[model samples]
Target: MILKTIFLGLEAGGKSIVIMNGDDAERLGVLSLGRVAIRFNGEEKTAIVHKSSKLADPGTIGVCKRVWSDLGLSEGAEVVVEAASFPDSLYFIRNKLAGRKLGSDEMREIVEDTVAEKLSDVELSAFVTALHSFGLDLDEATYLSLAMIETGRTMKLDGGPIVDKHSIGGVPGDKTTLLVVPLVAAAGLLIPKSSSRAITSPAGTADRAEVLMPVTLDLDEMRGVVERTGGAVVWGGAVHLAPADDIFVKVEYPLSIDPLLLPSIMSKKRAVGADLLVVDIPTGRGAKVKTIGEADLLAKDFMEIGSRLGITVRCAVTYGEEPIGSAIGPALEAREALEALMNMGTAPDLVDKATAIAGMILEMAGRSDGKVLAEELLRSGRAVEKMREIIAAQGGDPDITPDDIVVGEERLTIESGRPGHVLWINNSSVAEVAKAAGCPKDRGAGILLHKKIGEVVGEGEPLFTIVAERTSNLRRAQERLEKARILAVGDRMEMLIHEVKERPVVKRSFNLDR
Candidate 1:
């Protein structure tokens, strides 16, 4: 039946949902809560059906953003929705859940179905849970990666040895891509750094980069930007590479489990045509890998997967005991990244970590002294210049300065309770506080570190500052801080260390040696 599309500004997370008037549902023989095959612009998708009396007239169908987008229907545009059936691949997902080892063909079929959104959130979650329960072997992981790559778009740089970096992620405020990309680009390497939005943290590399420039670019635009400036920092999601990754990610967000890590990571890198890749594995307390042993095992898996795909992969097991830097929001992180690139940021840890990661990538690309080269590029202003060129190429102001970036107007400074040395900064607490302040989404909201572990703090000295776009958000962050032990201080905290110290140990305890 043809029905007018009415917008419903709600996130129908993991499923397309359409709302209809009770009279329409009763008259059209459509029941509320039943599946409907919605069609518009020669495209069709199954969305969960909802019925409302006051929401719409009898002839109209209410669509949330996902449905309207998936069907390509304009507001008030006519749509045809009918009863739909389950997809053929749904049985394969069930088989996986039954402890069956799926072959490459089966995996590819499932991935194809996933990318096409044939699987419901329930089906998708079932697949993720099956993998999470039974787990995927290296061979299976490789197949999944290949399948993910095949299911979406692929890009190839004009030349050889295009490099890329990825973090296992659990640490917050990780904006190294901003520094690493520019530094590597200055070294004349093609580093098309495609990052994600804030999956969990206050800010992701792409989110931070977006604060300076646009991150969403098509292949041609991204290639043009990279060709002009040795590198480009953009959102991988925007290019729609390995689309299954995001589908799983959306389900995993609520499930709180990371299934199919190998395929999910490798597929994105492979889709981007990364020949030389660096995987940053932050292993410590409150991190994805709680032990160095686990990190090593995961690192081995990454390298082996890379070998299967014919890519050179190096895994850098960095410290993830805390957030990467002092700034844990988009605009704030972008500002801090620039400051560090210019060698003017007080957050030495942020600068040092970026240099370390970039150096490793450089070393993998045949440079013996990667750190030295990275530092030189950063210090000599070449890295920043390349970054500015990239920013300009992506339609941002290349001449924009760090100070020109404005963070949230509302601010709150958290101070030490007593005179002591800094002991630790809880990664989870820091992330929570920043989230409370409205980071990633609220680009201007975040937390800034004034002191890190082992730093001396006088009574009432500021520990960190939180900035929020609105007073309510600032207050919300303050309320969250009251329960979180973000910055620990003790008369004897941890021993005082040099300002150049690069400790990645998180605030919590871990079993790394074992």
Candidate 2:
């Protein structure tokens, strides 16, 4: 049947959708959540159908933003509407739902439909949930990676060794990439780094880097920056590298599962033509991987996938018991990272972790004195210079300094009640407190630690300070802090952690940062 287009001027989060009148829908034999084939001007596209009796007239169809843009529909253009069949990928998804492993062709079709926006949110959620329920093997992971790479934009720079780094993030205040990018770039290597924004953590690498410079550079701009300065820190979502991973991320976030962790990380690396890669797994009781053994297992999987993708991969299992540095928000962490790069302050752990990872990349690329060289570059101010170059190339202020980065003005200092050595720090609690203070959004809102693990604290001395852009947010963070044991200062470790009185609803914390 032919119908007139009634523009809805709405976006369904990149999904193609159209609203049909209830009578027209009945004649077409399509349900409210069914599919429709919209054809106009010899061009056709599939859209999800939403039946409405009042919203749309009987002889007209309401076109959403995605479908409207795709078909170039005008206010009263004529279009052909017909009942559409479900995609074949749905069958494959059902097979996976039944706990059967999918083949390469099946995985490819599902991922293609995902990229093409042919699958609705419900279907996509079912696919991700099935993967989470019945974990995918390495073969399935490789297929997913290849399909994701094929569907998205890729960067191909003519270079000898294209190196990159990624952190399986869980720990808060990890500004390591801020140092690693400049440090590695200073050593003269092409590093087109694409990072993600915060999903679960207080801040992601892109969130922190955005404080220092613009991270939404397109592929051309990213390549230009890397070509000129040997490195760049851009947001992955902007580059469209492994865009299917972005759609999958949306499904995984609500479900609190990340079964595609391997493909999600490796596919982007492969898309960027990376020759060498380093994956950082922060391992500890408070981290995503709660133990060293688990970290190693994750590392093995990464290496195996890397090998299959023709990229040399190494894993760095670092200490994750606490926040990486004293800062736990975007602006504050950026300031801390800048200070470490300039050697103006003592963030030994941050410096150590950055240099160690940079060193690994260097050593993997055939440098024996990797750590030493990394340290030298940082100590000699070369890393800072290189960082400035990168900032200038990426359209940020090259003269940006630690003092120039503004943090939240409103501050609350948490004091130590008794004198002792700091025993432990809860990474999750730190993230929670930081988030309460209007974290990534506020940019300046965060926490600054006065002491770390094993540091001696005097009675009534300040333990940490929480900063916020607004008074209300500061109060909110204060409330969360009251219920959280963020830091423990004691002469000896406590044997009993917590007593369970009865059965409790366990809210499993899943770290979804990539």
Candidate 3:
């Protein structure tokens, strides 16, 4: 049926969509959420259909930005609309939903369609949920990784040993990347680090780094920075490496599931031509991997996948019972990282963790006393210098200092009620509080701890401070604190953790990060 085009001037998050009146939809033999083939000027495109009685007229079809641009449709242009069948990928997705493992061809087809925007959000959500429920075997995971790598852009850098590091993030305030990149690069190795923004956490590495430098660099610009300074910290979204993962992440965010974790990390590493890689698995209570055994199993999977993708892999099972440093938001973490790199302040745990990870990358690249060398790089002010160079290369201020970084002015300090030694810190609750304070979005909003696990605390002494750009956000965080116990302090361990007077509703915290 020939219909006039009405440009909607809006996007469906990269999906092609069209709206039509109920009468027009009935005449064309299509229903809402159905598919339609639109043809204009000898070009054809398929878009998901939405039916509206009043928004669209009987003789006109409303086109979204993506479809309108693809078809070169103008306002009141003539176009042909016909009912269309869904792609075969939907069938494969159905099979997965039925607890069937897909072959390599099926996986590749699904990934290709996903990149081509042939699958709608509902279809993609089904696929992601199926993987989460049924899970993927090693072979299936490998197939997905290769398919994603093939379907996305790749980088080929000329270097002897291109090293990279990743953390299966669960701990908050992890600005280790800010230190690791400069440390390893100062030791003469190529480290092109691409990180994600906050998914289910208060802050991600990219979010924190973005407080210091521009992270949204394209692939070419990323290469230029890496080539000049031997290191770079850019956002993965702009690079288009395994672009399908970006879409998958969007689906996984609301679902709180990440079945694609293996392929997601390995695919990006393969795309960047990383020869040696270290995956940090924060293990302990309050971390993703709650036990050392679980961490070891995860490490094995990572190593196996790296072997399949021709990248060497090692895992660092680090302590994750508490936040990495005193800071737990983007700006606060960035400032802490810079201070650590400059060796100006005493963040013993943060410095130790960063140097150890950087040392692993060094040792993987054939260096002796890797930890000592990494320490020297920081102590001698070389890592900070390298970081300055990287910042300048990425179009940020080279002379940026900790004090130069501004934080939120609205703040609240919680103090200890009783004197005791710090017993434990709840990572999830900490993240929740920071998120309530408008973290990541409000770069200056965050939390700073005055004490950590095993530290001494005095009655009425400061426990932690919450900072926010707005008083409303600070109040929101304070409200979250009333319901959540972020840390514990006591003279002795309490035998009774809690009392269950009746049937209790348990809410599990789900963390999804890359």
Question: Clashes per prediction?
Answer: 1, 0, 0
1 or 2, greater by TM-score: 2
lDDT of each: 0.84, 0.93, 0.94
List the pairs of residues colliding in candidate 1: 321-506
Report lDDT (Cα) of residue 501, candidate 2: 100
lDDT of 1 by residue, 444-501 (tens): 9999888877778999999899999999999999999887878688876457543646
- Ordering by lDDT: 3, 2, 1
How many pairs of residues in model 1 come into backbone collision?
1
lDDT tens digits by residue: candidate 2, 167-189: 98999999999999999999988
Candidates 1 and 2, the one with greater lDDT = 2
lDDT of 3 by residue, 26-121 (tens): 987888888888888789898888889777998998889999888887899999888888899999999999999999999999999898787888
Query: TM-scores for all candidates?
Result: 0.87, 0.98, 0.98
